[model samples]
Target: MPAEDILRIEGVSMQFTGGAGLFGRRNRTTVRAVDEVNLSVRKGETLGLVGESGCGKTTLGRCILRAHKPSHGRILYRRDDGTEVDLAALSRAQLRPLRTEIRTVFQDPNSSLNPRMTVQQIVGEPLVVNGLARGSEVADRVADTLRRCGLRPELMRRYPHAFSGGERQRIGIARALVTQPRLVVADEAVSALDVSVRSQILNLLEDLQEELDLTYVFISHDLSVIQHLCDRVAVMYLGRIVEEAETEDLFEQPRHPYTEALLRSVPRPDPRLRRRDDVLPAGEVPAPDEAFAGCRFQPRCRYAEDICAREEPATLPRCHFAEDLTLDGVYATDVRQTS
Candidate 1:
């Protein structure tokens, strides 16, 4: 692992077993929510995890934060002091101290924040719980955090119900940042807001990352948001990372067929330029418990051949024709213009 990497996910996988009957033989099915995945997150970069819903983007993020324990593999996290530890192996007691260093901004602000608690209490709870501050000191810290998130310090006394969707999201950001975390997992952080408000929140997050020197694992299905905010992008499909590259590189020249299809699905502003036949692969995602021998995407991939269905492809550059295929990407027009 590189010394500069703050988080390393090595062969991580999460499995859940279900389907037992009340008075029958044990016939459980194992669902691999996250299959053997390896990823490296640098100290101060935003890594975007993008995929369709149920593609395990959220599951992977949860595994990194230790909210959901991986059934297999190691999650190595390097602390701000340069101490490396396996977060996946840590017990609840052992992981408590590190919680302040890794925080999460959940998808739904309404459910994340306690409606009964005022903004001050919601944001200050972490400080009080961690024994980071006391009494007036906690209040002061909460006010500072609120201000930093573009919220008024005076609003700290009000309940979350009084705030707008964007304001509530800012409050959520304040809560995540109040502990002064080194890494923040923003799981669909701005997907619930208005288009106008989304930009404002995105800009705020960018500014905060600069000011705080924060590393982010931004999880979202929205490719546009990922393009706007992430430095690198990792495409997930069926509990595995299909492709990963720098944002520009992935947008300009996608390697995997799944990645190409995802990029093609992104809507362009010009209606005339949109192609009617630019549809994604047919059929829904396969069931998590349904075991398959060959490539999981072969069933839907237009480029699938006999070899694709008979042999399982390696996770890294899974496609047999990855090296040879000249897949279409968003930069085709730009390349043409330049030429």
Candidate 2:
């Protein structure tokens, strides 16, 4: 635990075991949604978690928020008082007091916000639940947070239905910030917004981060947004991080074939910059039941070797040929590229 690092995750794995059959008890299999994930978030920095859907980015995010108890490994979180706690190991009673320090801004405000609750109640719930404020104090804090999120304090008495989509998203942000959380896991925070409104939300997030000195784990499938907002990006595939690096470096000089394929998938603004049809392999991500003996990506990798199917790579950019292959990223070659 460096003083600058606010949180660290070591070998964290999350699994869901369920039974299947006619009565749903004959056969059981464990689906590891997240596996051996290790990461660090420095104070005031935004780290982006990116992958196709079902790649376990959101599961990992929820694990950090302690919304899910990880089946294995530790989630080491540093509190503002210079004390350290393993969030994974904390009991509910012990974790309750620290909930104010960690929060999540969920995607889809339409579903996340309770329709029955007023704006003030929705935003102030964290404060009330955490015993941080009572009655008028909650309203005051909620008002200020709403104002910071570009919502009118006067609107606090209104219900979620009264606000537009963008305004509702702002309300969601207000809810996350009202507690003055040091670590905020924004799971697909702006993906549901319209393109125009998305930029507004991004700008608001950036401004708030600067003002509050907040650390963020921003999860999204939108690479353009990730490239724009993240200081660093972690590319996940099959419940594991294949590559993690500074945003610019990862986008410009991707070391893994999976990363290169991801970069190629990003739609280019110019027709000339578009990727060719045959450059990368064409295959779907593996299903949860499609167990791999070695590298999880071998099923979809065009450059996979025999050893790749027999042994997993041991490092970040989890590819046996990462050092040998000259992969292309967004910045490396705008035109079509071959591995």
Candidate 3:
């Protein structure tokens, strides 16, 4: 682990068992939602987790937050005082204090915020629950947080129903920030908003990060958004990370076939440069319950060969012909022109 890293996810995995037959016999099926994922988040850096739906990005985020207990592995988190603690081993009571240091901004603002609770209650709940503030002090802190999120303090008394989509998202941000968390996991934070509103939220997040010295785990399927917001990115596919690199490098010179396909799928603004044929893999993602002896992506990967189907690839960089193949990335001209 790097000395500067605030969070370290070491070989983490999550499995869920379900499906019962009519006779009440346990089907005994297990789905590995997160599969031995190793990642690190440096202090004050936004690490974007990007992938297609059902790729376990959300599951990994939940595991980091201890919202879902991992089936195996450790999550080490560093405190403000420079003490490292194993979050995976902490009890619920022990985790209570740590909750203030790690918060989450959910995807659907409408569904996340309580319509019955006023913004003041929504944002101040964390402070009150944690016994960090009481009475008028909570209100004062809520007002300050609202203002920081570009919302009027007077709107603090209003219910979620009174706010627009953007306003509701701001309220969510205010709520997440009320605890003054060191690390935040924003799970599709802007995916549900309008394009304009998404930009506004993204900018607001960036400003808040600078002002508060916050570290973020930004999880989203939107590659464009990831490119815009993240310093580094990890691309997940079927519960495993296929590629991770600096944002510019990952977009400009993707090493993994999956990464290349994802980059190619991005719409080019220039009609002349637009891709005519689909560059994506042909088949659907494999089911989590299905066991695969070889590379899970082999069935869909156009670059896959007999070896790819015969042996399971190690979870390391360039596991299969990474140096030999020159995978395509978004053209530098297209990126420059767009920027």
Each model's TM-score, in the order given? 0.96, 0.96, 0.96
lDDT of 2 by residue, 1-339 (tens): 888899999999999987787887588888999999988888889999998899999999989988999999999998888989999999999999888889899999899999999999999999988889998999999999999999889989999999899999999999999999999999999989989899999999999999998999999999999999999999998799999999999998898888888888888777557674554657787776568788998887888889999999889879999889887878644565445
User: Model 1, 20-71: lDDT tens per residue?
Assistant: 8777588978889899999999999999999999989999999998999999
Evaluated against the true structure, the overall lDDT of model 2 is 0.90
Clashes of each: 0, 0, 0
Candidate 2 lands at a TM-score of 0.96
Q: After superposition, how far is residue 230 of candidate 2 from its true place, in Å?
A: 0.7
Model 2 residue 160 CA deviation (Å) reads 1.2
Cα error, candidate 2, residue 276 (Å): 2.6
